[model samples]
Target: MSLYQFGKNLVLVLFKPIYRMEVHGRENFPKSGSVLLCSNHIDNLDPPIVGACTPRMVHFMAKEELFTIPVLGKILLKVGAFPVKRGLSDREALRKGLKVLKDGEVLGLFPEGTRSKDGQLGKGLAGAGFFALRSDALIVPCAVVGPYKPFKKVRIYFGKPLDASEYRERKVTADEMTIVIMEQIRELLEKHR
Candidate 1:
């Protein structure tokens, strides 16, 4: 296994008994190809939590500031994370993500942009939609439910793959396209709730 995979596995094993995590619809994950595991972010641990449960190596677009720290940032970088500026559209970040997807790697994104301040799943940003539509990739909408606590039950609900072939052929505005994609992700989570 790769060092990053080893680290993730080590962390997951240590946290398993404490977190009492549960996962559903893991079978929905594609064995290979460009995939967007779009999810809701409710806690700081959400990314790692999702990563640990997933069988494939997934890259996440973390905040650039988070990498400013010395040791922690170094570790994050080694573990398949790249920086993305918040509050504005970073074309470079999107390009990096797109390239990763095009290489048949899994890209994890929180559709809400940042963590939900109210601890609830919020509306998704246009980026997720834009990436999915642009790449013609398969999107797996996931939900991270319940807060983290020792022995606390944390559930991950993975929705079925959302195919965007129809959108590829249409003459839709970027804004309209983004909304439609975000709405699809919202609907999946809402249906589970």
Candidate 2:
């Protein structure tokens, strides 16, 4: 197995018993081609939880600060995470995200930009929408419910893929697409609640 897959499997094995994790709607994932797994962020563990739930290898756009640490940065790189400056435009990160999509890989993004301290859904940043528009990749809305506490049952629901083909020919604002993705995420959260 690839290093990424091996690491993912190892983590999943450890997380399964402690988290009581459950994954639903994984069948919605596309069999092939580029896909953007846009999800709601509740905690630091959200990325690994989502990654373990899905079978496909997901490349995440983590904050650039995480890449500065020595050992953690090396591990993140090995797991297919690229750096993104949290507050600024970070054109370089956007280009890298687009390249991952164009290469027909699955890219994971937390549209809310940062973890919700109160576990409440927040407005999505424009970055996720911008990537969708630029790459014309399918936006798979995912909702990760419950806290990341040990022994607690954390559920991950992957909603249907949102197509961006309609906006391919027109000039649509990122805010518009962000709203749509957030709404879908909210719906999924409510469904499981």
Candidate 3:
């Protein structure tokens, strides 16, 4: 396991006793090779909280500013978390993310792009769809129901891996495509919520 996975697991182990974590459909997650985990955004804690439910290490794209902190940046880097620029195409972040996938790892992304202020899902950024199409990776739909108080149970449900059939060889505008992909993610989330 990577050091980040070790650290993440360690934290979960400590918290498991106090906070009830219920995970369903974990079998739906791909067992190997480049996979993209797409989920709705709810709380700031959603990333690590959802991370704790999965058996494998999942990387997420965090804002670039977070990496400005010296110690935290080093920790996040080792664990698979990479920096992404908001409101712009971050080619460097995309390159690094693709590299992680090439290394046979999972990349966790919030399709909604940013946290939802009212706890409702938002439209996804096109980058996610582009990544899936370009990399030919499996997209695992995930839903995390939360805003859990301390020691409260955080419920997470994993949906079946989405086949990128519709995205294959499609020649549509980026904006048009992102909406369709985001809707796919939203539909999955609605099933459990």
Per-model tally of clashing residue pairs: 0, 0, 0
Task: Give per-residue CA lDDT, model 1, range 38-155, as digits (tens).
Answer: 8888899888888988878889989999899999799888998998998998989999999988998999898788888877767677788788778867888788876788888887
Which candidate, 2 or 3, has the higher lDDT? 2
Q: Which residue pairs show backbone clashes in model 3?
A: none
lDDT of 3 by residue, 1-193 (tens): 7686677788678766566777888999888978888888888777887787776789889988889999989888877798999999899988988887788888898877889998778878888877777676777878876656677866788887876756666766556655666776677667766
Ordered by lDDT, highest first, the candidates read: 2, 1, 3
Deviation (Å) of 6 in candidate 3: 2.5
lDDT of 2 by residue, 1-78 (tens): 888888888878998889899999999999899999999999888898899888699999999999999999999998
Residue 95's lDDT within candidate 1 is 93
True lDDT of residue 184, candidate 2:
93
lDDT value, residue 98 of candidate 2? 94
| RMSD of every prediction | 1.7, 1.0, 2.0
Model 1 compared with the native: what TM-score? 0.92
Q: Which lDDT value does model 3 have at 179?
A: 68
lDDT of 2: 0.91
C-alpha lDDT values of all predictions: 0.82, 0.91, 0.79
- Candidate number of the best lDDT: 2
